[model samples]
Target: MSRYSKGISLLENLLFFWCGLSLILSIGGDNLVIPSWLQVAGRMHPLMLHFPIVLLLLAIALLWMKEESWRGFGKNLLLIGANFTGITVVAGLLLASEDYEGDALAWHKWLGVVSLGFSVFIYFFLDQVANLFRLAGSGLAVLILLTGHFGANLTHGEDFLFGPLMPKEDKMIALEEAEVFRDLVQPIFESKCIACHKEGKIKGELRMDHLEGLQKGGKSGPFILAGNLDESLLIQRIHLPMENEEHMPPKNKLQLTEEEIEILRLWVMSGASFEQKVMELPQEEPLFQLASNKFTTEKTYSFAAADEDEVKELNNFFRKVKPIFPGSPALEVAYFGASTFDASSLSDLKNIKEQVVKINLNRMPLENVDLSFLSDFQNLEEAQLNFTGLKSGQLEGLSKIQSLKSLAVSGNPFGEEGLENLKKLTQLKRLFIWQSGISESGREELKKALSTVQIDFGFDDKGIIYPLNSPKIDFDKVMFQGTTEVKITHPISSVEIRYTLDGTEPDSINSPVYKEAISLTKTSQIRAKAFAKGWIGSEETKTLLFREGMKPKSYKLTDEPHKSYKAKGATTLFDGVKGKANHTSGEWLGYTDSPLEIEIFLEKDQKPKAVELSLLLHEGAYIFPPETVEIWTGNAGTWSKVTIPPTPQSTKTEEIRYGLLAFDLPQGSFDQVKIKLKPIGKLPSWHQGAGSKGWVFVDEIVLN
Candidate 1:
């Protein structure tokens, strides 16, 4: 209390008071129920979560000024600080649990756990259970500095810690004996990052267990920026202001100590890199199995290896990435599917044409492999090989195909000077040149070359989207039944109606033109697609010939009971029914109660007769059964299932609005019509719980 008393300026008093108030109100331990409005705020990225952590660490440090500073007051302050920290941890945990991937976030998690641990220990000390406040406080600051620094690296990359240093400041340390990424970076990360970013609960989806895993990036994308640490997301996150929510290690988790911060900042600024100077990847022997085999099977498309070792590396990398995409259980299918990887003609790709989607072989070995194989997997999306031996010369082989969307050749010796080959690919979407041998001049040259194509190649999130002119239609729906001839209209001139009768996409040849005399009773969903080719159709001016004459086909009642009954049939499970007014018996159903289900079967006697459907009942007798009815005629039916609704809720049932369904009939009498109810949960009724037990009854009926 003395320490607090000494700092008690009006402002300090308010701070402590506010802290105490927060602690007290938050305990509200009385309610067993969690608050419904509970929400924690932070930018979605891991950088945002770091803010509170930095402040919390600093607040905790303030609790250890001196022994005479506050007597037992230090203990109380520590307890309050712990409470705030605990809340922050819980919130952070919640945020961390969201879906994300890549290994960069692995470091962020470790930093958090260390911070959480410090807070937990600090809690014990506050209760007079531990005699190490000074030691613990100092330890907390150090842990914070460590965790915060690493977490930032995982988000911003290596440059964040060590900014660019001139030749004067970089003192080359003696080279070590042996160098292994797992042995080096992994330890620093494990020691500083493994806490929260570990497998089970990584805050930003960053994990640093092994080498290939490093190839997998954080949520923002790859972490290494290939070979250039200066441009990596891992470093940028660390340098952020402590108050900025985007600060790494997350402000809520911990703060970077000045010493640790300085060390890292210097490291990154000096062109942070890890080099044991071992033998370069051999250009001759196959380090990666680039050949496609029957064994490679991962749905992300296909996995290519730079060599046999690279195959194993990709196998591991894919395994790590698989967890990132959930609900896509089929991803493992790649492992079970044919392995399209072989050592011969590494780029033969006869085996992976349509199968592989993502291929990762960063920094692997391979010089000449025809990239022509990339064309086969029209679905090929992501290709990464940073720091690999492949140069821009090989990229030209890939540029021919328009489907290759995301390509990263960063950190490689590939100079953009030879990027002319890429200009032909109008579909080139995301291209990465970070840390590559691509000079500023080369980059500019490549851009100048691609000035004609619509390419989103910038590093920032900003996207330049140019809307192209294309053909379009302006209609909500198309009617296939009664419409013997539909006037297919489009805003674009010289458009054609290429429709498919087999429910396939409409194209020019597979489907005949909708000439002036078009006829369709055989097609259920006849697509009166208006197409001009170059653009997607618009709705306002486009028209699909709708045959409103197409109505619900009254089903033939099975056996019909055939004879007309003297009284109307009605049941009481849900809605109640009265007498049938129209020629059909559809008025005999009561649609109420849960399950909100209603089934109707229709039987007809005549062959080749088309009929429309309708339901009727006495004004006050039957209503609401069809508030929302889902009617389905199994496959082969001429029409799509539909929802039928009643006019309104009231005692008046006679003036019942009609629920009509229409579509071309099969030119023959049908025996049964089955209508199924669904999706809408149990319907609620004021009658069952009200004065008069309201009831709606129904009966299957067909109209001709």
Candidate 2:
């Protein structure tokens, strides 16, 4: 024998030994106690697998190529390929001991062993069984292909090889034909929970992919109890706090959205039915509304996009111009900051007149502006000119805009004469003329003039006084650099919004009526209410505003915030973003048991006069005011502690509120500031979790 053949014989013997041992381990893999080190080795199987596939293909080609000269070379290559194949099988067997399970894994593993055995057999019997060697070589190739096919399915999911060529399934089902479980509940499980709890790789031995496995229960208990959310395992796991280890889909995985969880909860409450039709449920039920919204198709518009640079240029603090929905070519324009609006703002939009489908010039101080340009927007479908100081004559100019479908001229002084101009708009479908000095008799006449139009007169008071809804205040950051504008709006037309900036309640007769956005350059409290002729004023809406000072160069946290509420890390406090009452909105940094200690560095020229901590208070949620807050101001290593009064605790349960705690700093010019908040270590006696450690949630820290 040649020297190379002698080496091949030795490797062939080791291959035979490894193949036997790999088969034995794989057969008994179910009970094997795999260690961490072996798991690390098992993960290397993917990286080692390509070598055997490429070498085996080359070996078979060389041996069957009708060239005697290369037969010895092919034999040597076959032994090396067989040895690598044996090692790959061993690695795969070790991997099977982990979370991998299912029919795909089983088939892939056994087919790999068979391929290993076939390669070794072809190598040892090549010369003695020359006639069948060619056929065996072809058979070995088929085994390798089948093993690879199954392995791909195991890793990339079923139909990985030909999923694209298959017909795509439409996810949206009509409300009448949709089954409650198959259409709604099952999809939520497939997207969020099934990956870990499916047939082959069952975690906790629970299978959520189908109804039978879900009912069989897992190691924990029944997945769900019909008509009982309290005892259901699925409900309990999802409701657990995100910090808990047993939370479903895991904290690290894609957490279930609030709406998705609500769907699952509703499904369980409805006896977890598998064949219920969505439309069969009561129309007033929340589940029906959620399903209706899911299946409703959005309106599609056919129009080319506007120039990108022009859209960006037109969008500003006062005016917003963007696509109505993501990827849609149509655009919607809304103007804010009425004090800053001018005739040029409307004229400038002529750049992309064709793409503008909706224009909201609400409350834009447009009394004498030339709205003749509005007729140039040929595709305008909706126009909201509410409370824009529009006169009776301007309605004639709007009538020239032939494409108008929905028009709102509410809160203007125009009477029935102006309302008659809208009769020329043949395409008008809905008209809002509330509080326009047009009485019910005039509205009846206009509705008769345009029989097809739906005229909305808004809130016929009927001699009974109803309280108005509170005005919505729109301003994200409570702290501002130089000045901030706060806009207050009420949905009802012609209702007056009165406000006070000195923290006192606003009487409708005395307080200034809100028209434009309020500009603030100092710390102030704004209290507002809605007022009208026959309606009761709304409950007061209070907002605390602060003047920001000294932007932080950087900051560091002494202890980590809770994993679920870490809002953009150390920069969260100084990022000029504020969180609302909801703590889980990804804006607040929540800390429990530990003090929130932050060291902030400011610009060299900044001399902070005061410090403000924007915090949330919800006794029901176990979030309380800090016991005390300590602040120190200095640069370098010199520090002076500033004494502040203890923060008052909630004496009883109250609604969720966002409050500002301000402290005047000692007179100094300091670039470095350290703020430490000591959380109320334990909840007060009035709280439900009285003996447990409470939490303190902070959204923004202001230095002024």
Candidate 3:
């Protein structure tokens, strides 16, 4: 045989071998695992796929050519085309083995396989059967086109080419107008599940894009057994662990939120009815509340949309402008970063005043005069001035905004008189006056004047006449050398401050009332509480006082303090000053997700009577007293644990109080003392942030 002929025969044999291997792999693609090194090449199938397309088309064109020279070239072109098609099929199978499945994937796979088979036949036997070659060539062209279309759909998403041409409109309807099944349930399936279970991509042979398909069920049978969520396959798959193989939407797709899952559960449990309106559901039903909150339409205004250029120009880092909703013409303007707020900044929003339906200036540094521009926003429906400087007579211009439907002035010093000006805003529906100077009586009077408006005065204080406020401690240092007098005062002058020095919580009858400064000469744990008529007693405030002794010459910490709250170095522990209730004041050293270990060294050997550590406990902020505190004392290499304090029980309510863990040492001359404090590794179940690491805060450590 000639050298060229031998080379052609070798190439043909190689193509046939590859074509057979590709077909076998494609059949078992779902169970195959491509090696990590080959995975990258497999993923490149999409990028390298165009090569086979061009080669196949070139081979077909060459066959169609009337010229004898081009006809002769068709044989080599078919050989190249068959090899390209075989390799593409193999790459595609490797890519498909990695979690890719469904009807679309199968269709694309088999169609490509068929094209490969046709290419093989045409390459080897084109000369033997002319009519058969033409028929197979035409069939291969159609199969290639169909495979490419399905492949694009699987990679780029369904209807990628035709989706843009369809008319777009808001599919969401108001909760009042939405039906429980058609509007609420169907949309969720379409967004999260239908992509895999639709007609062409019916994974598990289950269809969800239509009601009839859902009723007909899939390979495993009916997804929903009416009125039974536990038996429903749809609910079961959604509730599965995200890492589970049977989990719906897969791990990478958008999973259902707790609320969305509950909505589906409630809908299925309610007989899985297809003709129920949301309003028709029982008012007390949980589904009714979820539907009302999720699907309710926002209030609409008839105002025109603001000029895009003007709105764009008014927006900056400190100022924001946006439409009220998806297709609404009304605009909402808000200001942030109070430090950058200027009085004249409000005037810049004048261009969109006619379209402005809401304005939020909460916590902004704008004065009363800056609010003068509010009168220009005649269409304003809602306004928030919470924590602003604007007070009483300053809101005269706000009264001109008759379209205002809701107003919030919480946390401001706006008194009862300031609220009277808002009575003229007859359109107002809700008012927030919490933390304002407006008292309970003032809120009642305002409610009577505006009979139709709902006035919110924040959470009910349970009608407590005088809710106990934190007591003020007048002593600078609870740990002093000789003696120090500490004075306690309550916020309300009429309330009596009672105290106990034995570490027991104070009571009205048992604890002595404080009349003047109490002088302390020795170490004591002072616990105090406020007592008043018709009110709950204040939280106990504990303080540790120590008689000063030899100061630690140097100290070393096992772990560095967190950078955010590293106080003035290790010496801050011996500074003799107590930190405020606020743990983030830079006075308290905070340790999170780790224990704190400290060793103190004295200038001379001395046997300290006791070692006192002051810690802050504010469970709401994830700050808890150390789970266990181990104290050790020794010289040089040998050390012995003096004591290990028991862990205190976690409290239910959030209370800010000081905790002192005291460890008494035995008679021994020790120069070095070590303290190991372990924090709560995970918060208790009662805590809102359960299963999360708790924080440990230490202000000062006293040695005497």
On TM-score, the leading prediction is: 3
399-439, model 1: which lDDT tens digit per residue?
Answer: 65566667777666656555665555546666776665566
lDDT of 2 by residue, 207-319 (tens): 87778889987888888898999989999999999999999979988899999999999999888888888877887888876776565222345567898778878877788
**TM-score ranking of the models:** 3, 2, 1
Give the Cα lDDT of each candidate: 0.44, 0.81, 0.78
TM-score for each candidate, following the candidate numbering? 0.21, 0.41, 0.51
Q: Write the per-residue lDDT of candidate 3 for residues 176-257, one digit (tens) a residue.
A: 5678988778878877887777654567878887888888887887898888887899888998988998998799998887
Error of 2 at 650 (Å): 16
At residue 298, give the lDDT of candidate 1.
Answer: 19
Cα distance off (Å), candidate 1, residue 392: 36
TM-score of predicted model 3?
0.51
The Cα RMSD of model 2 versus the native structure comes to 14.1
